[model samples]
Target: MIVNLGDQLFMQLQLRGTIWTQTITNLRTNWAVNFSIDLLGQSQNYLYFRIEQYGSTFVDDAVYLNSKWKFARPSNQGCTLAFRGIKDFVSTPQLSADGLSCSVVKIIQRAKENPRPGF
Candidate 1:
């Protein structure tokens, strides 16, 4: 799929060793700097991302607890997975100015007491 800077997309992140994956929808254009991924998420000192675009597949980038960034080549199937150690931060999903990395912040989820129908 061809994705530009302003295109909104959905992201499904599956952390290693975890049986369940989190499905994030309406991720917005700020997070599509790379290709559409199926499983991508960060817990606390580790970052994981997969790149699936056109005929190319690769992990693309990995950030460790020390705030280090590394670029790896695509694997045989065009898909790659990486793991690293980094510092832990409050997890509030945030996009960086360059749209390359996600910042750390606390996330709070609340349900609407009253439901509103579409007009």
Candidate 2:
């Protein structure tokens, strides 16, 4: 989900017999753009994502961050993402012994907009 500063997005996923929820928050006081994947209730052993700037106007100063789980079960978790000024535009998944895979089923983006009633 894409979120600007002061905004929060919540997502829930169900896997096996458990339901897990993830909440992402943009803590910057200024406008910040980011994308996140929540593998809350998933059993996947690995996850990865690649970011490409579609236009030349896209500046290299933009920063992106990501977090994920590294173990077969949720008990062993890991989080890593590129910081500002970093050159790596892709993230590699840290997999578990089971070597499972994950597919993105749904995505939701929330951006703050002027409040309007009954549009």
Q: Which candidate should be chosen as best, given lDDT against the real structure?
A: 2
Question: Model 2 off-target regions past 4 Å?
Answer: 1-17, 29-42, 50-57, 61-68, 73-119
- Separately for all candidates shown, the number of backbone clashes (residues 3 or more apart, or on different chains) is 8, 0
In the predicted model 1, the residue pairs found to clash are 13-40, 45-86, 57-78, 65-85, 65-86, 65-87, 90-105, 92-105
Writing each residue's lDDT as its tens digit, candidate 2 over 1-119 gives 44443344332233434444433334543333334455565565333332333453332222233333334443333323222122323335354445432222222121122111110
With candidate 1 superimposed using the best TM-score fit, by how many Å does residue 26's alpha carbon deviate from the native? 3.7
**Model 2, global lDDT:** 0.34
> Which residue pairs in candidate 2 have backbone atoms (N, alpha carbon, C) closer than 3 angstroms, thus clashing?
none
Alpha-carbon local distance difference test for all models: 0.32, 0.34
Best candidate, TM-score-wise?
A: 2
Name the runs in model 1 displaced over 4 angstroms.
Answer: 1-5, 10-18, 27-45, 54-119
Q: Report the lDDT tens digits of candidate 1 across residue range 28-78.
A: 534333233333332333344322245643222211121222213322311
lDDT of 1 at 92: 29
| Angstrom error at residue 55, model 2 | 10
The weakest ten consecutive residues by lDDT in model 1 span 110-119
CA shift at 33, candidate 1, in angstroms? 19
